[model samples]
Target: MPRTDAGVELAGVSVRYGSAKQPVTVLDSVDLRVGAGEFVVLVGPSGCGKTTLLRVIAGFARPDSGSALVGGAAPRPGRGAGVVFQQPRLFPWRTVGGNLGFALARHGVPRSQRPGRIAELLERVGLPGMAGRRTWELSGGQQQRVALARALAAEPGLLLMDEPFSALDALTRERLQEEVRSLAGRLGTTVVFVTHSVEEAVLLGSRVLVMAAGPGRVVEDLPVPLPRDPGTGVPELRASPEFARLRGHLTEALRPA
Candidate 1:
């Protein structure tokens, strides 16, 4: 199993784009700490640096100022976390198993052990026996599932998702949301998800961090106490009064001031 003790810490982290003389700050002195095995969500309107903060945690982009750490060390690209992006971004030339095999190879798994690992990962993501299917042959939801399975191939301690289900149909989105929440709990993996929907944030996050635009900073850090055990269905949770209250609070927080 992947290490479940990896947490995140950010202190005074900032990012800027464009020339120094005419810089556009994207994140301003953001301070955050995500505990191990916690599901944290980032939600806000456009231009609020949600993606930027995700990138920082993934080590894809360095902070212009301050510090960002994952598992108590500076994050390095492809090091300690798995990332799922808005698009599936699978290799068109590779079959479902081929794609997952690539990830396993990168993680230094032996070739002899790869087939079993690939099967296990596919099963975990609800894609059992899909190793033979071509990437183009699968539906959008299947493609995304493959993308997710690929990310989990190495069983990284931390998973970062940037609006991963935004393009899916409503039913598919909801299903995937439940799968992710349940999977994270079962595996004890730390998750940091980014979404524009307040409902999604409340549904999946143990802690929701509401961000604001204009140099992008967190304005509200709220805990969600809803039950997320395997037996708790999404529909039941969504209809609960506590869910309604948390959703309303996050929605109100995003409104323009």
Candidate 2:
């Protein structure tokens, strides 16, 4: 999928929950802009509304005040963006190909084209020939790969992920992080990723937004200085002095004041 000029915008966006007598603000007057094909990560403590902000962009949640837009229009769910959740959320009864085919169908892909499309999606996610396997038959990492493949089945311009690799083991998490970063760059997909790990944020994000709780807001927005070359492997990058310095900087910014 070649890159498209799909971007995200939020202006004075606010979200609240709870009773009328005592509403709790999950997001407070948040403003953000994500350009086409950029990778942005949201990092914050538990109550900072990172997921809520994502939902607003995904068109799954509406803001109580202000506005949110994707591709220069009010966001509509399942339109121009694909989302990968923290869980694989695959159907146990569906084969890997079947799962991706479902997404293609929802995206209005021709029925006859689905097989080729599913195969391509699986191959892109590093699961080339396992589409026939049931979702339950795969390991956790494999399942997550299928989830990612499903998300990409639509060839969406915008990809939204909420800590999609957090459940995997360390080795698996790192491997997936590398794959996702490379894939997004290669496809030129705009991405908004949410995570609590500062390392993960630094590794995957071109720009990182640090949020704070108690009426969630962005406290810091920092652009990553690392190279995005696919040839620069994650291990090599992580070992660099620049990477270490940036990680320390973000760590300090995340500290409670």
TM agreement with the true structure for every prediction:
0.99, 0.98
Per-residue lDDT tens digits of candidate 1, residues 91-182?
99999999999999999999999999999999999989999999999989999999999889889999999999999999899999999999
Clash count, predicted structure 2:
0
Put down candidate 2 lDDT per residue, 120-154, tens digits, no spaces: 88889999988799988899999999999888887
Candidate 1 Cα lDDT to native: 0.95
lDDT for each candidate structure? 0.95, 0.93
Q: Whole-model lDDT for model 2 versus the true structure?
A: 0.93
lDDT of 2 at 164: 94
Candidate RMSDs in order: 0.6, 0.8
lDDT of 2 at 227: 90
| Deviation (Å) of 140 in candidate 1 | 0.5
